[model samples]
Target: MEYRKLTESEIVELQNQGCVASNWDSISVHRQFNTAYIRHVNFSGDIKLGIYEKEFTLPGGIKKHSGIKNVTLHNCEIGNNTFISDVNNYIANYKIGDNVFIHNLELMYVDHESSFGNGIEVTVLNETGGREVIIHDKLSASFAYIMSFYRHRPALIHKMQEIVKLYTQQNTSNIGTVGNNVKIINTGTIKNVRIRDYATIESTCHLENGTINSNEYDPVHIGYNVMAKDFIISSGSHVEDGTMLTRCFIGQACQLGHTYSASDSLFFSNCQGENGEACAIFAGPYTVTHHKSTLLISGMYSFMNAGSGSNQSNHMYKLGPIHQGVMERGGKTASDSYILWPAKIGAFSLVMGRHYRNSDTSKMPFSYLIEHDDETVLVPGVNLRSVGTIRDAQKFPKRDKRKDPHKMDQINFNLLSPYTVQKMFQGIEVLNELLSTCGEASVHYTYRGCRIKGSSLRSGLKYYDIAITKFLGNSIISRLSNCPCTSDEEIREYLKPDSSAGLDKWRDLAGLLAPSTEIDKLIEDIESGRLTCIEDINAVFEKLHKDYYSLEWTWAWDKIQEYFNLSPDTITAKDIITIVEKWKEAVVKLDWMIYEDARKEFSLPTHTSFGMDGNKKDQKIDFEQVRGIFEKNAFVEAVLEHIKVKSKLGEDTIERLSKCL
Candidate 1:
């Protein structure tokens, strides 16, 4: 693609075709540039034009030749086979890439040097601005998690900030770029933005200082009435339908539409926001809300769902929105629920009704926080038997929409990880202490301003023991999967841990469930300037994610020894058989519980409106047709099959151990 000064005769032909140039000598064109396609276009200020010979067949079978018509360009370069038409204002100070189709654009320009949304400090979590995450195009949920939550380590924070600053400085430029194969149609007022390859911007309004990180693998889409400022929307994400954003970072494969608005927020992979509002929040992977009046403000959430009319108060009316809350992964809120800020919710917990009390359930996972008589009542370890919880865990990995090869977020959808299991361990200890101190005969107990009934406390203890038995059983069984252990020594050798990495406490660092010891090592590297590059930091996270299973086995083995009162050196096949028997019982009991819970969906009370104009038999037929019988339900069958499989596994292991005896 060579550019040459236009000939005198070619200039005359362009002039005859309603085209004008401020300086004829300043304009340059490709050697194969045709004057026949240039019509009614105004050009100025050092322009370069490419060969336009391709035909674009648009929707509705409209064939359009790639050419420039009815447009005004200033200090711009047009790429090969690109089409530009019907610009109301101008396209200036930008380079339009190859094969782009631009029509009905009002304004597109670069006024000054910009980093295109990189290094934009998004005030997440706390609105008064104590916690701010520097957003860049390659920002991952784990990266933002450490920066927003680990502000106490000033040296680490300073090193991380400086690394991001250097990257942003390298990206600063005066000339904006519209990459190859982009389509910008009926758009208005794009300023100081970088449009990457294969992006589609249709009918969008007012984008400023942003990066649309579109690629061939996963292109981004910005549809009608979308207005954003100081943002970085990653690949495969769609932000459209009257959504408004300011100072936000939208990670890969997220959806924001239906008039949803957010300010100073960071939404990571697979998160959805529709018909709601968010302010100063950190929404990690799988945080979703699809109802109106659901306001998420000054909160940190991951793998969470907000019900309709769910709200949280960030201000006590005394301070200026300085409070924040954390709902650990897999948390949910019932419709019309409310919580005051500075509260911490446990993993896989449910909240129902309004609660004025700031009860922190951080150490009690899988609990129900209910408002009864204006007091919070905690029901612990109930979600383990819930069919809905199992379904949610199964659906997250299946529903992942990210198609990018280089994914920014590393998400783990495992429900029974060390992070939650550690919480359950603490829960059992806490419940036992309460029983010993409050006396078993007492009817109710209170902790952290939340009431716990005596029956609930007993049930929690039983449930935790069963679940821990199930987990440890599963771990030991998996460890000795194919080992031919004929004697006690062989059994002990087979059950040895692969690594010692997971002996420390585990933390759910956004989506990755990893040991705190590993995270501390990463922090040390950052603070000591060994991991200065952002890519290097991300690589460490990826390695940690890859080694999760090896690390998990070590953690599970330690817990097994502690909970089952056995050492690897002294443990025998007989002891393993005992654990397996407990494991089999726990697995069978939980499956039956979940199976009974699923049956509730098909109960008679649920069939009230099924047969409105019919009798009892007709009602039965309608219910069976609509909801299906509980026996044939997919989840119910899976649960029953799990019981069969686990029971057989236990019996087989016991028989092998009997042979050893």
Candidate 2:
């Protein structure tokens, strides 16, 4: 884009069109600049103008030509075919890009040098400090997870924060950027912000010191009274409807609206917040709270949903809001439920009532923490056959709205990965230990500040065994896929792990599931300076996410041997056939359980709400009309189909294994 000094005739024409400049010599115009389009504009300091030969086709088929009208610009470079009009205050020290539209804005400027919200330390989990995540444009959920969760590694934290600092310095600039194809209309007070291509900021209020990392493919939308400071809004996100944010990082495809207020929080991919408040929280992928009275504070969460009036207390009075909690992935709180801080809930668990204890059930996945007569009762391994849990697992992958080709968060949507399955293994040990210590005849047992009924204990054992069999069977079948299982040597060769990467424990690093040993190796690299930069760390996380399945197979093989008590070196087709039988039985049984759970939704009690003006027959008809019959429900049908598929898969595998005879 070449610019030339304004000609004498063009200067006269601009002046005649009600334009004023501090100094005529400081303004430069494009070679084909037309003076007819510049109207009632005041230019100060320096200006580089572009030609206005394009017309924008707005909503309702209105055509408006691109040009400056009734605006003041200072030290700005205007781009080609852009439109600027009705700015209440001047836009200063900004580089406006091509095809951009700026209209009816109050103030858009850069007062001083700024980093555009990069390298801002967000205090997450423990608000008093300690667990601050250094936020930047490239920050990922797993990256933030390690930074906030691994506070014991001072060297690692320092190294990562230093890398962010360098990035912040590189982004520091006196001139703010409004990139190509942007639309800023009816906005107020945007200062020290760097906005990228295709971002639509309409009716937004008070955005300062932020970076809108928008792209053409998946543009960000900030609308209707959004006020944000010290933030980074990632691609394909929305901040609208009077939402207020401070010191936060909103990740890709997330939705925050309906007066939601968030401070010192980090929300990763596909998370949502509406009509609620979040403070000092780490909301990983699919964490959602849509109710008005809900509050998520000082916690680490992923794949969890907060019901209406759900609240967590971080202030223990003595600690001064320092205590934090963990609700591991796939957990949910019933409406009006509460929990005290410093508590740890297990994966796929449901919190159904208020609890005052600092209960820790981290090892018990797929459990129910319900308030039975004001006592915290743990019904373990119940959610394994829950209709809602399976439906949630199925919905997560389908609900992912991220359209960006380069997704910042490496999310794993698998419901039964080694991360949760390993917890099941430990949970089995925990339940058995509790039953043994309390004596099975005692009727009720206590463990980790929660009560377990005798019947629930036995049922938990059954559920965990079924889930384990299903998992182990799936792994062995997948390993033996396409193999000719005719000999012991061939079967053992097929069952052997391709690598030893996943032999040990597994971790859910926010959303990415990988082996503990591998995560430890990466941490060692970071602490020892082998992974010196954020990009290097991110590259490792990305690689771990991509290699998850192969690594998972390695972990599953070891668990199979240990759980089923089989030596891998001498494992034969007969041993595998035995595992398959257990797996087939487990699969059929669990599916039947889930099917029964689904049936409960359409039971007699549920019909009460359906037929308000009719009798039982009308209730049945109305219920079927509104919610469909249970047999034809999409989820029920899917479950039925799934049972058929898995049953066939199991039978096929058994027949193939019998060939060894």
Name model 2 segments beyond 4 Å from true.
none
Question: Judged by lDDT against the true structure, how good is candidate 1?
Answer: 0.92
Worst 10 residues of 1 by lDDT: 652-661
Number of the top TM-score candidate: 2
Report every candidate's CA lDDT. 0.92, 0.93
Which regions in candidate 1 have their CA more than 4 angstroms from the true location?
Answer: 655-659
Listing every candidate in turn, what is its Cα RMSD in Å to the true structure after a full C-alpha superposition?
1.5, 1.1
Q: Per-residue CA lDDT of candidate 2, range 1-661, in tens?
A: 8899999999999999999999989999999999978999999998999999999999999988999999999999999999999999889999999999998999999988999999898999988988999899999999899999888888888878888898889899999999999999999999999999999999999999999999998999999999999999999999999999999999999999999999999999999999999999999999999999999999999999999999999987885998999999999999999998889999999999998878999999999999878789999999998999999998999999999999888989888889888898898898889878888887898888899899998998899889988988998899898799889888888877788899878899889998889989998998787887778888899999999889989999988989889997888888888998889889989999999999999898888888789888888999999989899998899888988999899889889989997
Residue 255 lDDT in model 2?
Answer: 98
TM-scores, all candidates, are 0.98, 0.98
